[model samples]
Target: MLVFFTFVILLALTVTNSKQTFVILKKSREDWILDGIGLFFQGIAIPFFQIAVVFQLYQLLLPDTRASLNLYPIAAFLLSFVFVDYLYYWNHRLFHTRKLWFIHQVHHTVTEMDVLGTSRNTLWTSFFIVYLWIHSLFIYLLQEPNWYILGISLSSALDLWRHSSFSPTVNSWLYRCLSPWLILPQDHAWHHSQFIQGNYGANLKLWDKIHKTYHKSDQVPDSLGINSSLSLSKKLFLPLE
Candidate 1:
């Protein structure tokens, strides 16, 4: 699936450029070298940040769960994942609108699209996933097991895909046909395009369609950011836009 979607998207981007333009775009190698470290630290950061800050407060209101019926854990885990994805749809659409674009614009500023581009985002951008709060609320409300861990895993996987540039999956008919339901590179490219209305939600495709923010064209283009003067990498400072 990844290969099929990544290929079409990469092909679309290449045809748009007549060559792979992002290959020449330069960001500091120091930035590249530290990505794994960043990933590791961040792996620990948000959970600690949220658990220490939020979940601890949550557990205070709950009865003892160390001996409770654990069967609910699986249902809670699966349900929480879907709800998080669903709310991400709204949070993402909001970022595309004028009210939230400033934060999101920071991310699209990077003219270079690569795996490293995933980690180029600012710290506050992490808060955009504050939908984790929703996960927290449900987990606390239900006191399910391992909800927190599932949140971390699902979020990390989605974030990894957001910055992955060269997927070969987009070439398949199933990918294109299902593009409206899933966010493939074509949809992401539209969000990253220079033209107006390209910036929309990332994880879910239907939100853009329902909200009338979707951008579609038979021919793809070369440029990927707003025509701004600031360094593109600096633009990822905000999750809005």
Candidate 2:
């Protein structure tokens, strides 16, 4: 979920690429609506979802338990976010595979990169996330701290970075200062490429590499969109089915 927050940074990166893209977004209704909705869901709704799932997990872990204003709950939240991002790497890849592409193609339908471009996803993707179940499972198993909720919050907030068009200054610095421990804009953008038969992890490229899904690139993509046919209304509603 915090992976979702990093997307805002990705949006900033996209804007820095050129003023023309910003000008174009300012004129589009979809951009405005998508940003508004994405912000709310990622901010308010996502926290509520986390809280709800954490509460449920507590109850399941101790069927007769009542929560204290304690630290353990927060720890559980943090552990959940860390684990989810790892699982999400593969889940995101699954979305791009044969048969599954029918769902993920909706996200790729966006032909451009921008802040709003991240919202171009099939609604069903949400259901597939099953955030509550996964979060609950992590809490039950890890018995992590309540303070860890901070990580979950941070993870959701930073997800904005994944969809941004912004290139990094560290293209040269990453190898020295960073390890491919987590996913970056360039890694995610690879998932949106016209040739996306491989490299599909989000939030971490290391998993992609280990899984033999990694691809190296020197530039941000010049084009993006789904390879299949779709209608606007269908794209919005297909997730329901």
Tell me, by lDDT, which candidate is best.
Answer: 2
- Local distance difference test, each candidate: 0.56, 0.59
Q: Which RMSD does model 2 reach against the true structure?
A: 4.5
Q: What lDDT tens digits, residue by residue, belong to model 1 across residues 1-241?
A: 3333543464466445633555534445644533434454345576677778666666675556422434365676656555566677677667767876666665565565554455444556656665546655555565355754465465556555555454345556765675656565555666677775643554566666777777765334577756555443444333332
lDDT tens readout by residue for model 2, 1-241: 4455465455555556667365555545654554456456544665476568665656767664343224465455545555566777777767767868777676776555555656555554555664545654444444344445555555554455556555455546754354356666666676678886666654556677887878777566777765555555556557454
The positional error of residue 15 in candidate 2, measured at the CA in angstroms, is 6.4
For all candidates, what are the clash counts?
26, 42
Q: For candidate 2, what is the TM-score?
A: 0.72
Please give the range of 10 consecutive residues that has the lowest summed lDDT in model 1. 232-241
lDDT of 1 at 79: 61
What does the lDDT come to for candidate 1? 0.56
Instruction: Indicate which candidate wins on TM-score.
Output: 2
Give the Cα error of residue 34 in candidate 1, in Å: 9.8
Residue 216 local lDDT, model 1: 66
TM-score of each: 0.65, 0.72
